[model samples]
Target: MALTGAGMSTASGIPDYRGPTGSQRKGSPMRYEEFLHDPEGRRRYWARSYVGWWQIATARPNAAHAAVADLQRSGAVGAVVTQNVDGLHQAAGSERVLELHGTLARVVCLGCGAVVPRAQLDRRLRAANPGFAEAAEGVADQLRVNPDGDVDLPEDLVASFVVVLCPVCEVGTLKPDVVYFGEPVPKDRVERAYDLLELAPALLVLGSSLTVMSGYRFVRAAVRRGQPVAVVTDGATRADADGVLKVAAPVQELLPQLVSRLASEPADALSASR
Candidate 1:
């Protein structure tokens, strides 16, 4: 089994939250409670998201993503569980992927439970706020895209920004379908991830710090089961002590090399070892 995270997508122009070059973000992201109860916070989030969404929408899968697909096709990997919400694994033709966090491609209505494509919301936002995009771009000339598809905008701009309500139920608030900080992952999703880990003989971690409990718990579970864990990431990770093998390298260069070596090995040897 392969578990990936934000670093896997860094080469595709999206920034990770806690990587070496991270911390470009000015403040904390909108929390679940803040988003639920504070209209002002919601407005700030949507405004920054509206600008950041273009970068994510236009991003293409990089070599790391393609290598994972190649590995899966060669029968070296059976399942993928990712903490990323970018949808790059699916775009790279990996079918058996489980997104631990919900995707940014969707939005859900808080009141009516209606889910809609994010593109539709983008259209609505564009129509409602004419000239706002250009104005925002002018203010933040070098806006950086964060992992959750949010950017840092001036407070003056954020305060003046307009947030659109859900079209299905006008009274309901529309939020991107992603697990936010201080929010728990859905119970079913967590169970499914555990099921994936339980069935695998070894666990391979890619590009995650494993700092958060969500990803760390899986590593701890694998250790308790006596399953060997191999981690491929650039910096220190929470799983370093538990991992049997830890490779400090950029995934974009490492994954393709790993896939090539695996593919060249004898089928029986690869099956017996993995």
Candidate 2:
């Protein structure tokens, strides 16, 4: 099985939370508690997200994502678990991807529990805040799109942005379906990932630093089970000392080559041929 993270989508124009050396590159992200309790925080979030969504929506899957799909088609990789909220894995033709953090493509109502496509919410936001996009464009150079599809905006801009209520409930707040930094992933999803790890012969980690426990736990579980673990990323990972075969390289450059080699011969035969 292959596990991926934000680094997998960085080549697609989405920035990763951490730098190549595992240091945080952006400012503090929104916390779950803050978003849920602070009305002003929600407004700020929606305003920033509204300006940043276009970059994520227009991003195309990179070579790394396509290589993963090719590996899956050849039966070289089974179960893909990704920590990225962007739907690039699916966009690249990967099937049945297990999104550890939900997706930015969807929005959910906190009150009515109604889920809707993000595109629908985007239209509503545009309608409610006319000329907002043009204003955001004025600071486009200063705006940096974060991994969670939000940008840092001036306070005046954020205050002026209007947040729309859920159409289904008429009063509930709308939130991106993705799990925030301070929130716990749903239990069912965690359990399912554990099961996938237990059944897999080995674990291939791509693009993740294993910095967060949410993705690191799986690496630890695989190690405990005596599963051979291999990591392909660009920098320092928490699991570097866990007896993993760590390859510090860019996934977008390496994955395609790996897939090409694997497709030409069986695993055992390839070593013999080499």
Candidate 3:
């Protein structure tokens, strides 16, 4: 089963990454390359990121996460593939998880690939943007974290702050280990996730609007395999027409109840044969 996107985490109150309905404030957000190559872009990135990191760091797993974890224990779910970088699935104790989007728990220096705890970066960013701790108090209400921890804030503020250079490589750039938009998912991870998907009789997709092709690829694969695929989300999904079932609802409001119902019942009821 794959529970993906900002829709899944909305229950935990984390915002999405793209528009008014999502997290970006204005203009195109910076990608890994822009943040690395352009001085002005890096400055814009760090200024907004200085505050966005707080929200991403503080977000906790919600009931949907807990229920999903419980499903694994009950043997109702063979594996979980997620598009979240929040690490909520682990926090809720799901063991067999594949993070399609990568996690935010660690930061890697792009120049050296030396890994460091993200907490270290947060402290440094807070130190550089002294008012950050104060300013960040309610700012999450307005913005969501970009893949590299930056937020899309107003033009002036984003352009004003300076991005501190990577300590390890003064001339080199920094990037999160996350797979960004326009970047392909690593081949090894994709193969492993597909292997897991092959074990399950079907794939259940939840809380994804499926706006991006990255997440939708699995749904397509599942359907092509004739695996019963279902989608549950607030809005129309790119997979809705092809999905065997679709539910328009919030993941938080519906997932716990659904997982509990499905977990308690015999798998045979869902047409699964032992």
Candidate 4:
């Protein structure tokens, strides 16, 4: 089962990071280069992110997360692969899972490739930027999660935003564990998900538009193998054309139902396992 983009998490109270219909930095999600190379742009991102981080930190998993976990426990789903970094599935007790785009709970040092949990950075940010000392006054519909997994501020506050630097490394910059634009998803990761597909006869996609072919490529593979594809989302998705079961509704509502309907047998659960 694939938990997709923004539409998947709306019930969790997290805003969609992309689209005019969604929230956060507000255009088609910002380009990775802008966050890395541009100063003012970077500041805008960090400021919004700083405030946005609290939203993600305090956010809880909704029914979608619970249902998926239930599906796993019942041996109906082998693995729960996701593009979201919110860590909701694990929190809900899903054992075998894949973070396809990476996770926001962690930050990676560009220089040495060491990973650090974002909670540590949050503490540092509170000390470094006193505005966050109290509590993040939630921003309306911010991506909350960014390329660096560092901080996200609202658009209104972007102009006056300041960024917190990496405390552990002298010169290394921090980046979100998620795949950024222009970055390629590890081939092994994609192939590993395909491994799970080999065990199942279908790929059920929820909440994603499948615009990022990195995640959608598996859908294509599922089709090539004659695996059934089902999708649930309120918005138009890039993979709508490929769906055998398309439900124009929120995934939070449909996932639990779909999981309930799945026969209780996990013979083909998770990334193509032998």
Candidate 5:
């Protein structure tokens, strides 16, 4: 089984939250509770997202993503479970991928439970706030975009930003489908990941710090089951002590070579193996 995280997408132009260079933004991200109860928080989030969404939406899968898909095709990998919300794995042709966190490509209405494409919301936002994208572009060089489609902007700009309501239910707010910092991962997603890990003989971790329990719990469970765990990442990870093999390297640089070597083995043997 393979588990991936934010670092995997860094090569694709999306910045990871906690990397060697540190977080792109200094302050804490908007939490689920704050987003629910505070209209201002929603305004700030959507405004930043309006500017940053283009980065994520236009991002292309890098070598790391392609290598993972190739590994899966070669039968060297059984399943992929990612903490990333980006749809790169699916875009790269990996079939059995499970997104531990929900995708950013979707939005859900808070009141009516209606799910809609993020593109639709983007259109609505663009229509409501004319010339906003052009205005954001003026300061594009001064800010960095984060993995969650948020950008750093001044307080006054955020305060003046307008947030659109869900089209399905005009009175309801629309939120991206991703799991926020304070929100728990859905139980079904956790169970499915556990099931994938339980069946695998070994667990391969790619580009994750594993600092959060959501991803770390699987490493712990694998250790308890006596399954060998290997980790490949650029920086120190929480699971380093438990990992049987730890390689410190960028995923984009390392994965293609790893996949090539793994693909040299007999297909049937590899399929029956790790």
Candidate 6:
């Protein structure tokens, strides 16, 4: 099994929140509590998200993503799981990928439990706030977008920006369908991830620092189960310790070569090594 994180998409022009050494590189991300309890916070979030959506919407899957798909097709890797919400794995033609966090390509209505495509919400937001996207680009400092598709905007601009409600409910708050900071992953999703881990003979981690418990727990679980674990990433990871075979390198360059080498190896030898 192979697990990926934000670094998996960095080659596609998206920035990771933390560097290789597990240090935060971006501003503090909005928390689940803030989004739920703070009205002004919601306003700021949507305004920034409206501007950042373009980057995510236009982002194409990079080489690493395609290589992972190839590895899966060649039977070198089994299950694929990702902490990224970008949906790049599926875009790169990897099938049955499990997204640890929900995807940003969707939105859910808080009031009526309605789910809608993000593109549909984007259209509604555009109609509600005319010329806002263009104006935000002019005002924002370099328009740097965060992992969750949020950009930092001035307070005045946030106040002036209009937030559109969920169209289906007509009065509910609209939130991107993703797991935010401080929010728990859905129980069913967690269970499915464990199932995948239980079935795999070994674990391969890519591009994740595993700074947070969300992704780190899997590494610990693999260790507890006596499963051979390997980590290939550019920076320091939480799993860079005793049992894991750590290789510090850029995944975009290494994964393709790794796939090729693995494909040529005898299946019995590979299984025996694990």
lDDT ranking, best first: 1, 2, 5, 6, 3, 4
Q: Which ten residues in a row have the lowest lDDT in candidate 5?
A: 19-28
TM-score of each: 0.97, 0.95, 0.85, 0.81, 0.95, 0.94
lDDT by residue for model 6 (1-274), tens: 8989998988887888785422422457879999999999999999989888889988999989999999888776888989999999999999879999999999998899999999998898899899888888787568776789887788888898888988886999988999999999999998899999999998999898888888889999999999988998888888877579998988999998987887788989766655
- Best-fitting candidate, scored by lDDT: 1
Native-referenced Cα lDDT, model 4: 0.68
Flag regions of model 6 displaced more than 4 Å. 20-26, 266-274
Per-residue lDDT tens digits for candidate 5, residues 122-223, read 999999888887777775676677878888887766776778887877988899999999999999999999999998889999999999999999999999
Over 4 Å off, model 2:
21-26, 266-274
CA lDDT scores, all candidates in order:
0.90, 0.90, 0.71, 0.68, 0.88, 0.87
For candidate 3, report its TM-score: 0.85
Q: Regarding TM-score, does 2 or 3 come out ahead?
A: 2
User: In each prediction, how many residue pairs overlap at the backbone (N, C-alpha, C within less than 3 A)?
Assistant: 0, 0, 0, 22, 0, 0
- Write candidate 4's Cα lDDT for 1-274 as tens digits: 5545656566766666552236443344546787677777756655555666766777788888887787777655667778877777788788778888788788787777778888886677666677642334544343444323334444555654456666677567777677777777888888888888787766878777778787788888888888888877787777777746788887678777866556443556433332
- Return the clash pairs for model 1, or none: none
Candidate 5 TM-score over all chains jointly: 0.95
User: Clashing residue pairs, candidate 3?
Assistant: none
| Candidate 6 TM-score over all chains jointly | 0.94
lDDT (tens digit, per residue) of candidate 2 on 102-132: 9999999999999999999999999999999
RMSD of 5: 1.5
Q: By how many angstroms RMSD does model 6 differ from the true structure?
A: 1.9
